[model samples]
Structures are given as C-alpha cells and as structure tokens.
Target: MPKSIKQINEKIKKGRAVIVRADEVPELSEKYGTKKTAEKIDIITCATFGAMCSSGAILNFGHTEPPIKIQKLWLNDVEAYAGLAAVDAYLGATEESLDRGIEYGGAHVIEDLISGKKINIKAQAHGTDCYPRKLLESSFTLKDLNQATLYNPRNAYQRYNAATNSSPNTLYTYMGTLLPQLGNINYSGTGELSPLNNDPSYRTLGLGSRIFLGGAQGYI
Candidate 1:
C-alpha cells in the first residue's frame, strides 16, 4: 500500500529510512478443486531493481553491475537512485502543502505517492540523455577530476523510442522548483538535445534507471 505524505513526513522527521523494491515479479495463483488441494506454484521472472531512500542518502541495489563508462558525464545506478531519493526527501521534508498555497491535500499526497522507483528510473534515463550537454557546460574539466559535479548537475533531457519516433511521445522538459533556471529542458530546438534515441552515451551512464517527481512548485 502507498503511504501518505503526513505519514512519510513523520517517518522522515523521526529519521525513517526505506528500501524500495523495484523487482517485477509474476502474479501468483491459487487453485481449489473437489479434493481441495493446495500446492506450491512457480511463475515467470521479470526485470526490476531495488532502491533505498533515507534522510541523508539513497542507494540502488541491483543484481547486475551498473555501467559507469565516462568518469565525467556518467551517473552510476546508485548515484541516480540516491539523487532521486534526495529530491523526494527534500519534498517531503518541506511539507509545503500545509500552507495556503495548496487547496487540495490529496493532490499533494498523490503527487508524493507517485514519486518512486518507476519515476526514478525514468528520470535517470532523462539524465542520461542530458549528460553530454551537462559535461560540456559544467566547470569540471574532463582531465582533472577534483569537483564531482556529476552527482546532480541540475539538468534534464528526453527522447522517444525509434518504433514510435514517427508519431513521437509527448515532448518532455524538466520543470521543478529545485531545478535552476537553465534552458536545457526540452525535446528539441532552443536549448534541447536534438534527435533523441537509445544512444550508447545513455549506456555509458548506466542501464538507464530513470526517475521523475512531477508537479507545480510551491504547492507541495
């Protein structure tokens, strides 16, 4: 079951930490007959990863080794997972919805509820698409590795799958209260990554663990 913002806030205030299990599993089944026999059942396995979030840190625990090719632009699965978790902790810690800026607490609660592993994975992928621009623009030199701006550079990017490129999904841009006033958030044109695809650069970052936490700022 999903947790409420109030509940999550209390936990955070009390220094509550959670491990999010993103592993996709097969649906279980049960059988009943005239004999009324119950037996163990086996099912299929699916792809999924684990995520952990705390007031101070976030961790992405997975069976497979994360791909971290470029030291400058790439964000490992653990960093991606932690970054998103930190964002969520920031949101939950703020508790802005209690103010008059919000009319419906449910909306704020729902928004908080949806910010999880699924969104984290997507956001990580978006970060992957934006890595090149981030590296080129940041102060960190590719040669001298001192300041690690690669942790969370405040940027965003998106692209559609090749099969659906002709039609294309809704053009996405990064918009958040925490996000600085940079124009790098767009699908294309006027400060955007043009021609999106499942590029190898994304792989260089990692297997694309994307995360997203969406909503108008100041509301919640």
Candidate 2:
C-alpha cells in the first residue's frame, strides 16, 4: 500500500503519526517486514554527514567612522573574496592560510570567530568619494560583525563512498590519512540518515525547505 504525503501530514496534525529516525528504518523494516514497517511509520527525520569541502560564509564587517570599499581582503591570514558589496566579503572554508598552509584556514577562522576569539582583519581598497578609506587593519569577533552567514554550496550528501589510496606513498586527505596500497580505508556519510535517501522522490523536501545549519535555522 502507498501512503500519500497529505495522509501522513493529516496524521501528524492530529498528533497520531509515528515518527522515527532514518537510521532506525532498516532495522524496523527487517523486524516487521517492509510493508508493515512502512505502515507503522509516518515520518523519518534525516540527518546526514560527509566530508564537506564546498562550503563558505559571507560576512559583513559593518563600517567604521570612515567606511572603506574593500578591494583586497583577508581574514585571519586566509584570503576572502571582496568583490561583493562595499563592506561584505565571502570567505571560503577551504581557503588555506597565507603561511599556515593546511593547518589553519577560513574554516578555523570561522570557528575562532564563533568561539569569540579575536580575528585579525586586513584589507586594501581604492579610495572613493563616499567610501574613502584605502586600507584596513583591525581585530574583531563574531559579535563585532554586522552579519556572518555560513553558506555552503554542498552539504548533506545523498550518498558517499569509502576512500582508499592505491599508491605506493601515503596520501593526506580531508577524510584522513589514506595508507599506501589500500592499507587503510576512510569513508563518509551517515547512511540512510542522508536527506535525499530518506525521500529519494523529493516527497518531503523542496527548494524552499528549511533546515538547521550549524544549529541555526536556514533554508534551501
């Protein structure tokens, strides 16, 4: 038997629908068989994870007594794109620090900002009539900024596979160290809990769907 989303939603409104985690669906289906399990469950809450690389944040540094149009920008030694509006810039998570290489970058900078740690802000600008300042160097935290919006282009994978290296030398990866000649295996994703897998047909999610990103409410 098939259950329409409307029917499930009706049960939910009446507080009679049964909700379960996506991780539990496999076991439940095995215990009671797929048909019975499907009838018993009305909603599945999906929460998935994987190595996220295509992610970044847009930040607004507010303004100073003499506002500057940032032309070149860096946050905590990690470069950011400042081609947007006057006081705003986009910081990519994978942007490596100028001297720290892979050790520290935009991701760490964002974390430090969120932790209320001081972040060194640097920028250069062409003096303008309205925004005349040509250079900026200062320190601030998350609270000191007008806005810090984390916008990841890719997140919550539908499915992902384990990683392995077949080379003779060790490989450094975001997933972790991949040993030589397939000596070790690294993987990502939380299996069925992945959003798309829970509703492969786009039954419960869409363009305007809302989700919680980093414990903050966001939309798709």
Candidate 3:
C-alpha cells in the first residue's frame, strides 16, 4: 500500500523512515526489486563533494548615540556598501578589498565573527551639528552587533553554464582559471542538493521552504 503524506511525515519524525542514497538505488533495486525498494525508502539523500555557491551577509550595527551618515565603510579591510542607512550595511563573500586582495574578504570576516573574534569596523562621515563625528574606528564581535544575518539574494542557482576560453593567453575569470586556446572547460555547481535540480517542476519545494543556510536553519 502507498503511504499517505501524514504517515510519511510521522515516519520521518520518529526516525523510522529508511533513508537511501541516490547512487545506491540500482543495488537496492536488484536486492529487493524496484517496487519493494520504493515501498521501503522514505527519503533520498544527494551528495556533492564540491559545489560553488554564491552567498553573502547583512549586518546592522544598531543606532549610535549620535547618528551620522556613513560616507565610506570598511569591514576587516573589505569594502562594504553602506548606502542603506546609517547603521546598515551588506558584505558579499566574493568581494575583494582595495588594500588587501582576496586574502581577506567578507566571507573571512563573517567566519571570524562567528568564531567570536573581533573585527575592525571603520567608517568616515561628514561632521554635522547633530552628529559631529567625522571618523570612527572600532573592533566588534558578532555578539556586539545588533543583528547579523546571511542575506544572499541569489544562493543556489537553478542552472549554470560551463565556460571555456579561446584566447591565446590565459584568463583569470570568476568562472575560474581559464587555459589558453580552449585547453580546459570550467563548470560550477554539482547539481547535488540543489533546490531546482531536485524539484524540476517546482512541486514540493516552494515559498517558505526550510533551508540550511550558512550552518543555520533558514527559510526560502
């Protein structure tokens, strides 16, 4: 008999559902026939050893005693956009600092903050009567911030295209190092655990779906 949605959910809640890997379907099918395997399996898990995903974070520094519009901002040497508000800014994972290349980026700063390490927060502003502060520099940890959350506008892409260079010289692109004369092809995303790949027609996964984001439970 086919299991109902409620029954399947109950089995999952009780940890009694049989979990299977996508790659093991063939072996399991041979062992217990396709029908029997389908009846027994409740969940399928996909695996991708390495997958490149774009992500970023937003940080709110809360209100300062004397509010000043930030004209320039830098977090851990990485330039962050501060045009949203006086105390709001966003940091991207792949953003490179003007002083320090990719050696220290927003992703590294976020990791350090998560690990309870202090990071430098510097800002410059034009002095005003209400807010006379022209420059400010301080060190702050994640706990010190009013709010910090990952806000990746585009996380897992539905699909991606591969790239190759036909130029005579090598090219250093975001896609990765491209060899000269179409020597090698570059591709990103492994398809495993991708929301779109699993739900091609977008039936089960939809708005407000729970997702694992940056080691935390979030919703899409």
- Candidate 3, residue 21: lDDT: 69
Ranking of all candidate structures by their TM-score, best first: 2, 3, 1
Worst 10-residue lDDT window for candidate 2 reads: 152-161
Better structure of 1 and 2 per lDDT? 2
Candidate 3 on 1-220: residue-level lDDT in tens? 7777688789989989888767677799999999999898987765333334466778888756677677788988888888787778888777787787977777788778788999998988886887677787888998888988886555546357588999999999868999999999988655555556666787656778776666677777
The regions of model 1 sitting more than 4 angstroms off are 13-18, 24-145, 151-155, 164-220
In terms of TM-score, which candidate is strongest? Answer: 2
Instruction: Give the Cα error of residue 83 in candidate 1, in Å.
Output: 30
Cα lDDT listed for each candidate? 0.25, 0.86, 0.77
Per-candidate RMSD vs. true structure? Answer: 22.2, 2.9, 3.3
Model 2 ranges with Cα > 4 A deviation: 27-36, 114-118, 156-158, 167-169, 172-176
TM-score of each: 0.18, 0.81, 0.79
Can you write out model 1's per-residue Cα lDDT over 71-132, one digit (the tens) per residue? 22112111222333211211221122323433533223323333421221112223243242
Model 2 C-alpha lDDT per residue in residues 60-125, reported as the tens digit of each score = 999876989999999888999999999999999889999999899988997887788999999999
Clashing pairs in 2: none
lDDT of 2 at 124: 94
